[model samples]
Target: MQAAAPDLWHHYGRTRADTDRGVPDFFPWIWAQDGGPGSEVLGDVTGLVLADLGAGAARHAAHLVVHHAPARVDAIDASAAQHAMAGDLYGHLAPRLRTLHANAAEHLEAHPDEYDVLYSVFGGLDFADPRRLLPAAARALRPGGLLAAATLGHYLGGAPAEPDVQHADIPARTPDGTPATMRRWVLQEHVWTKLLDEAGFTAIGVDRLPPATSGARSADTLLLRARRHK
Candidate 1:
């Protein structure tokens, strides 16, 4: 029931504890691109149920526990490879973090109105079809819920694109030790915000951060926050 292809996350989860150098902070929530903008300021999450969709390597979700003290954090990802990375990073926090290997969309369908905050860091939210994800996310959130997510901003041009069929990139490596590439769905600003509105969220805000330049090209990202109006 996975929306993304199985091969997309294979190489990413390959590192073991010995072979690993160190798991760098990918999403700190401390305002770094690697981490998030820090959960304490994100919303009222402490002592509340929270889910981190697309919790690659489980950094952000783990951070929630160590820094913010959420009662429980479900770090869900569809790729076992991704979970492997999570296992390495979590060390002894496996039970506390509750990392799960299942298609995020499928998991959400079974648990309704269960989360106070549902967040993603360029995970299933940006890669899978929003038609399937946003509605499910709305269902997972209780009334007056919040979705704090980070996703890809407009890439080439700010044109509306279909949600079901799109492509995105994952940090993949070939067996020969070269960068591998894959594409999944990435929504234009209007397309994504509208989907949230249709899914029953309101006051949706997408905050665009400064672009990162590599020689000539620039990478743009957006931090989105939406509330489920009960």
Candidate 2:
């Protein structure tokens, strides 16, 4: 979690303020990275319960509440600081937007078949082992429920597939700026399709959105929408 901040900041620093005041600017890009509103893939969830694994300041959760208007949303993340920020951001959502401090992979075990939509946005799935995380997410969703995620493309390791404006060569650091050994996985199209299939998702839709940037460092990210088979 802490390890991934430097890369996040490097790519978003220009648009995102280094402090709380900058969170708003940061969210649009985050939402964009997520391949637009979740409903485009997950179908409608107007009255269904939702869970945002790796809620990360709860930007997506807020969007779900505002746009999709789900009955409830359990926004989960591993970082306390992020949780605190989420609490501050969507605290007013009440009974609708709930914040949870937990790792997405382990947290799902406590919530088997609980959500109509179990989703993530550039969260645990892309940062950790996707194979393990997808299965866990599958276990948490109700039958026929949705599992949506957006992640880094496989080409990030070598060269930019498009242009990136906020690119920088910085060490992976915490929000406070301490360096850590970050863990990130960049997966190709086939690798993602195979992983989702192995996770018990029946109707899976994996697509590559336009690049986040168009500069020399632009690498495409993948968006996945998989449904849990009954």
Candidate 3:
């Protein structure tokens, strides 16, 4: 038997989850999360089966369930802490908003053709290996189903995004306050488009959403939209 690694995301969103317990009224795709395009990017989610990949705390998924009338929105996150937090905050919306604890790629692979819409807001698309995750997403979505995700347009410290598939070891903290690093993929627009096309997606489009304001930590967001071939 082997012990599991410490949850690197254990402390993420903890402070906000405590004060803001209500389901969000809006969903932002930009990195800032303050303003930008909302759920309209997913078109009409009404009565649609959707999943929020790498949904941290599931605020956006909760919003869709409460305000958009989705048939169901599975908030999927690999982090045990995030899954627990999502349940604690919006478990009352069950049946519509279901929180799942699983790796995004593994979950999608397990539930082929299970979702009509799949979107990640700086979530799985940023942290997971696109080679595995994107193909799994393509297999998991029904033909012509939408796949939307927001990711970094460049490195956070004003560096250019990678021209090819690559992952950066970004700093992270473990559950017991130990220092760690996690892989984050921040690829250029054409790189992402090419990857999506190769992964069985069509009509791929990427939009660069510049931050509302400039700052050291602020980086542009790449909003990607595509559909599985019908």
Q: Every model's Cα RMSD, please?
A: 4.4, 6.1, 0.6
C-alpha lDDT values of all predictions:
0.72, 0.69, 0.96
TM-score of each: 0.79, 0.78, 0.99
Best candidate according to lDDT:
3
Instruction: Give the per-residue lDDT of model 1 (tens digit) for 77-179.
Output: 8877777778767856756578888888889888999989999877878767777888898899999889888776655344433454466564566445567
Ranking by TM-score: 3, 1, 2
| Candidate 1: worst-modelled 10 consecutive residues by lDDT | 23-32
Q: How far is candidate 2 from the true structure (C-alpha RMSD, Å)?
A: 6.1
Candidate 3: 10-residue stretch with minimal lDDT = 23-32
Give a tens-digit lDDT track for model 2, residues 1-230.
45443333333322332454322322232323532433456567788898888777787677777777689999998777677777876788868989998878888877799888987777777566666778888899999888878776644444532232122232466555666555566666667777789889888777777664565555555777788998
Candidate 3's displacement at residue 112, Å, is 1.1
Best model number under TM-score = 3
Error of 2 at 5 (Å): 14
- Give the C-alpha miss distance for residue 219 in model 1, angstroms: 1.2
lDDT of 2: 0.69
Listed per model in order, the count of residue pairs whose N, CA or C atoms clash below 3 Å is 14, 4, 0
Model 3 CA deviation exceeding 4 Å by range: none
